[model samples]
Target: MKLFYEDVNLQTFQAKKTDEGTDQQGRRYVVLDHTAFYPTGGGQPHDTGLLNQARVYDVEEIDGTIRHYIEGTDPLLETVHGEIDWVRRFDHMQQHAGQHILSAAFENNFNLKTVSFHLGEEVCSIDLETDHVSEEVLKMAEEQANELVLENRPIETKWVSQEELQQYPLRKEVAVAGNIRLVIIPEADYNGCGGTHPTSTGQVGTIKILHTEKQRGQTRIYFVCGKRVNRQLGEKHDVLQSLTAKMSAPQEKLADAADRLLNQNKQLEKTVEELKNQLLTFEADQYQDSLVKAVFTDRPVAELQKLAKMIVEGNEEKIVLFVNETDEKLQLICGRSADSETDMNQLIKSVLPLINGRGGGKPDFAQGGGEKLMSAESLLEAWVKQL
Candidate 1:
C-alpha cells in the first residue's frame, strides 16, 4: 500500500524517512516513502516546504511517489525529516472543498457536469458542459451553492471497491481500476478525486462568481471565495473613490458629469474652428501680393493645419506659410503655388534642417516638426523670402 493510502492526516508525523535520489541536470531531488505535501496534479499546484530544515522549493510526482526539490549547497542523503507550510495547505483545503460544493450544485440544479477545474493563485474556476445557460439561471445555481456553504454540510472521503462504486451515483467518469477513491459531498455530490479538501461546506465562506463566458460549447465560471472576496471588494471600492475624485463629482453623479464635460469640450472645439476660419479671411487680406499668404500663430497643431488648408483654398497661386508651438516643440507647414516654377521640396529640405525637423509632400505642400522652436521663426522667414 502507498503511504498516502494509510489515510491523509495532514498533521501526522513521518520522521526520518528513507528516500531515493537522482540527478537529471546538475540538480538532485528526493522521492520519499510517505509525503504530506500534495503533488502538482488535477490542475492544482504542488506544495513547498523545508525538508530537514533545508528549503524544499518544489514538489512533483513521478510514477506514484512524491518528489521534493531542495535548493542549497548540501550533499544528497538517503533519509530526512520534512515540514510542510500549514497555511498554504489550508488554503488548498478551502479552494478544493469550495470547488467540489460548487461543482455538485451545478450538477444538481442544472444536470450539467463539470468538464474541467483549475485552482489558481487568485481565483478558482470550473467549466460546465453546456454553453447556452442564461445569466439568471447561473445566478440561481450560484445562490444555491452559497446556501450550502451557510448550511455547513458534511464532506466525506473514503475508498470503495470497484464493484461497490458501481452501485452508487457518481459524477466523474469511472476508471477501470481495482479500487476507487471517492469524495462524497453527501446529498450534494460524489466524485472520484485525489486532491485534499475541507471537512465541511461551511468552511468555504462566501462564494462570488465574478464572470462567466462561453468557450467551445462550455460555460467557464471565474469566481472567488473566503478571504479573496474581501480582497476583491477592497480593490473595487478604491477604483470608485479615485474616479469620483478625478472627475470632481459626487459618487452618484460622476458618470453624468463626465458625459456633460466631454460634450461641452467637443462643442467648444467646433466653435474655435469657425473662429479660426474667420481669422484666416482677415489674414488673407494682409497678403504681400496676389500669391503670398502668411498666417503665423503659436496655436495648437490642429489650428495650424486648419489655417494652412484655408490659405491653399483661397488662391491656387497662394503660398501658405504656417508656424505653431506645442510641448515646447515647433511645427511648420508650407503650401506653395500649384503653378510656381520654384522647387518647394528642395527649398524645404534645405531649410527644415535649421529647425531640426523633416517634411516633404508634393512640390506644393510640405509639413515638418522639431524641438528647436527658438530658431523656427528665422527659418520660416528665410524660406518665404526665396519663394
Candidate 2:
C-alpha cells in the first residue's frame, strides 16, 4: 500500500522492507510493504528522505513496486521507519493544487482548456488548448484565480467507478476505466489526476504566471506558487540593486538609462572608426609606388584589410601584402589594384594550408588568419615569394 496515496500529509511511518534489488543502473534499492514516500509520477518529482539510518536519495515505482534507492548496499531492518521530506512534498502539493485553480480560471474567463501540465523544480507550466492567449485574458484569469484561492475552497479527492464519474463536470475525461481518481475544487475544477495536492486552495499560498511561450500550436504558460513567488522576487531584486548602483538610476528609470547608454556607445564607435580611417590614409600615403609588404604587431585583421586596400587603391600598379602577428596566431590581408594581374583570391587560398588558415574574398582582395608557425617577417617573405 502507498501511504502517500492514503494521506499525502503522512510524513513518517513504519513499513516492512519487503524485498531488495538492483536497478538497471546498478543502484541498490529496497521495496516496502507500505510507503509514505511518493514515487515520481504524474509530472511530480519523487520524495527523498531516510528509511531508518539509510538516506533514501530516490524513490521510483517501476512495475507497480515502489523502490527506495539508497546510498549504500547495507541491508535495512525488516521493519524500517520511513520519513518523507515533507517540505518538498508539501511544495509539490501547493503547486499541483494551484495548477488546478489557474487552469479553471482560464477556462472560465476565456474558454481556454489546459492540454498538458509540467511541474518543474523552479517553475510549473500548463499548455493551453488555444494557440494564442491575450494579455488581457491572462490578466483576467490571474485575477480570478487569486480571488478563488482567497475563498479557500476544499480540494477533495475521490475514487469512483466509471458510472459515478458522470456525476461530476470533469474538465477532461479519465484515461483509466476501473480505478478512477478525481481532484475536485468546489465550483472550480474536476479532473482525473494521480498527483498529491493540498486539502484546500489557501494552502497553495498564491499563484504567479512567470511567462509563456508558444509550443506545438499551444501556449505554454509558465507559473509558480507559494514560496517560489517570494524566491523569484528576491532574485530579481538582487539584479535590480546591482544595476541601480552601477547605472545610478532608480528602478523605474533603468530601462531608459540602458537605452541612452547603448546609443552613446554606438556614436562613440562611429567616431573611432572615422578617426582610424584618417590615420590609415596618412600611413598609406607614406608607401611609395611599389609592391608594398609590411608586418604589424597586435594589429586586428580588420585594420590590416583596411590598410592593405588603401595602399593598393592609391597606387594602381602596386600589389599590397600585410600581415598582423600575435604570439599564438597570424592574420593576413592581401589585395591588388584594378590593373594588377595577380588574383589575390587564388593566391591566398594556396598559401592558407601552409599555415592552416581559412578566409576568402574577391579576385582583387582577400583576408585570412592561421597559426603562427614562423616569424611575421619570414611569413611575409614566403608570401612575397609565391608571387
Candidate 3:
C-alpha cells in the first residue's frame, strides 16, 4: 500500500523493512513494505526526510521498488519510524496543484497543451505545445488560474482501470494501463498524474506567472505559487526601493532620470578626451629639432603610444623614443620619420633583449614591453645608441 496515495497529509508513519542493499556506487539504501516518501518522478523532485533517525537524502523507484538512499552507516531494523519534511512536502503540493490549475486554464481558454513540466528550487515551469504566447494570453491564463484558486474548487483523485478512462474528459491520454491515477478538477481538467497534491484549490494560495520564453519550438512559462509569490514580490520591492534612493528620483521618474544622467556622462567623457589630445600636441612641439627621448614614472602605456604618434605626425624628420617605468613592469614606444633611413623595428629588436621584452612593428615604428630589469633612462639610451 502507498501511504502517500492513501493520505497525502500523513507526515509520520511506521513501516516494516523489506530489504537493505547497496547500489553500484557503494551507497546504502533501504526498501520498506510501505512508504509515504514520494520518489523522484514526473518532473517532481523526491521527498527528503528521516528514516529511523537516518537522514534520507534521495528516493528513487527502481524495478517497481522504492529505494531510500540514506546518510550515515546505521542499519535498518525490521520496524522503523519515518517522518516526512512537512515544509518541503507542503511546498511541493502547492506548486504541483498550481501547475494543474494553470495548465487546465490554458487548455480551456486557449487550446494550449502542456507538453512538459519542471519543478525547480526557486521557480516552476511548464512547456506548452505552442510556439509563442503573447502578453495578453499570459495575463488571461494567470487571471483564470487565480480565479479557480479563489473559488476553492475541490481536487478529486481516483484510481481507474484502463476501460474506465473514457468516462471522464481527460486533458491528455493516459500512458499507463493498470492502476492509472487520475487527478480531476470538475469541468476544468482530468489528467493522469502520480505526484501528490493538495485537497483544495485554495491551498495553492496564489499563482503568479513570472515570464515566458521560447524553447525548442515550445513556450516555457516560468511561474511561482503560495509563499513563493510573496517572496518574489518582497525581493523586487526591495530592489526598486534601493534604486529610487540611489537615483534620487521617485519610482515614476527613475527611467527618465537615468537616461539624462547617461547622456551627461557621455558629453563629459568626450570633453576630457579632447583635452588629453591637446596636451599631447603641446608636449610634442618641445622636441621638434632633435630626437624626442623621454622617460615617465608610472605613466600609462596608452599615453606613451599617443605621444609617439603625435611626434611623428608633427615632424617626420625626428625620431621618437618614449619609455614608461612602473614598479612591476617597463613599457616603451619607438617611431621615426618617414624619410629616416633607420629601421625603427630593427633598432627596437636589438635593445629589447636588454630588458627581456618582445615587440614588433613596421620598419618605421615599433612598441613592446616586459620585465623591469633596467632603469627607464638606461632603456632609452640603449634604443638611442642602436639608432
Candidate 4:
C-alpha cells in the first residue's frame, strides 16, 4: 500500500480519495488510499506536490494514515491525479543516501557510531557517538564515503519481521517491534530507516564534510551532498575573488594585505586621539586663572568631564562647573582642585533640585543628568553661587 516503497521513482500516480478533514489549525487535508507522497518521518522532511490542482504543502503520517495538507478548501472527489515535486524529492534522497554512506564510513574507519541525524534546508548533519573527531579522522571518513559513491553499490530495502533481524549485520538496533524496514548497502552498511533513498550509491554523486564540532559530548558533522557540493564551492570561490579584487592583491597574498591595512588603521586612530587630547589641554589653559563656570550646547557628558578634570589639574585654586544643554535633558559636571576646601559632592546636591537632576560622587568630583528645567547658564551660575 506504500507507493514510495513500491517504487521511489514513481513521481506521478492516481489515487482514490479516502477521506477529507480539517486539522486543529483548520488546515484542510485529504487522505488517499494510495499515494507516492512520502510523509515526514525518520529525520526526513515530507514531500510537497500538487493534487488535483490543489497545492499540497505538507504530507504527514498520523495513526498509519497519510494526510496531505492542501492549500485551498477544495472538495476531494473519488479519483485525483497526484504529482510529487521531483526536484525536492531527489535532493532529499541524495542527502539521505549520503548520510548513510558517511555514517558507514565513520563506523568502518574510526569505529564511531552515528547517534542522530538532521536533514536541514542548506545542509545535513549526523551526531556521532564520540567526544572528539580530529581533522585526520574526518578526512579519512570522507575519503571512504566517496569511494563507496564511486563504487556505485546498489542500495536495497527489505521488509522483515522482528525475529528475522538477527540474519543481517545491522549497524544499530531497530527500535520498532513489528514491520521493521531495513536499508542495506551490501558489505558496507545495514540499518533501520524509513526515509526515501536512491537505488544506487552513485546517485548520491558526492559527499563533502563541511565542518565538525562537539555538541552534548558528541561530534556533530555538518556536510553537503551531490549538487550542493558544487553550489558551496561556487559560492566560496566568488567570495574569495571579491576579497582579492577589493584588497588589490592576489588570492594568495590577500591575508598579508589585510594585516597591513589593519595596522595602518590602528596607527591612524591613535594619532587622531592624541590630537583631541592636546586640543582639550590647550582649551583648559584659558580658564586657569579663575573659577571656571561654562555651558556648552549639545556636548557629550564625557567631554565635559574631561574638560573639568583638565581645568582642576591646571589650576590648584580654581573650581570647575561644566554643563551641557541638549534637546530634552541637561548634564552637569563639578570638579575641584585638591587644595580647594570646597566639597563638589555637596555642591552638586544643592543645585540638583533646581534642574530636577540626581547625582553622586566623592568630595573632589561629581556628574549627573536629568530633565532640562533650567537654562544651562542659569544652572552653572547657581552652582557658582553655592561655591
- Using TM-score as the measure, the top candidate is 2
Q: What is the alpha-carbon RMSD of candidate 4 to the true structure?
A: 4.4
Worst ten in a row by lDDT for model 1: 1-10
Q: Per-residue lDDT for 223-322 in model 3, tens only?
A: 9999899999999989889999999999899899999999999999999999988998898777766588889888788888888877887465778888
Tens digits of per-residue lDDT for model 4 on 289-372?
A: 668888899887887788889889846677888888999998888888989988888888998888788997989999877788
Candidate 2 global TM-score: 0.89
Ranking by lDDT: 4, 3, 2, 1
Q: By TM-score, how accurate is candidate 4?
A: 0.79
Whole-model lDDT, model 1: 0.74
TM-score of each: 0.67, 0.89, 0.76, 0.79
The predicted structure with the larger lDDT, 2 or 4, is 4
Whole-model lDDT values for every prediction: 0.74, 0.89, 0.91, 0.92
For residues 200-241, could you state the per-residue lDDT of candidate 1 as single tens digits? Answer: 888778888888889898999888877787888999889889
What does candidate 3 score on TM?
A: 0.76
Name the lDDT value of residue 34 in candidate 3: 99
- Between candidates 3 and 4, the one scoring higher on TM-score is 4
Q: 18-55, model 2: which lDDT tens digit per residue?
A: 89988899998999899988888888888999999899
The worst-scoring run of ten residues by lDDT in candidate 3 lies at 309-318
Error of 1 at 46 (Å): 0.9
What lDDT is reached at residue 46 by model 1? 75
RMSD of model 1 against the true structure? 6.3
**Candidate that scores best on lDDT:** 4
**Total backbone collisions for each predicted model:** 0, 0, 0, 0
Residue 87 lDDT, candidate 1, scale 0-100: 67
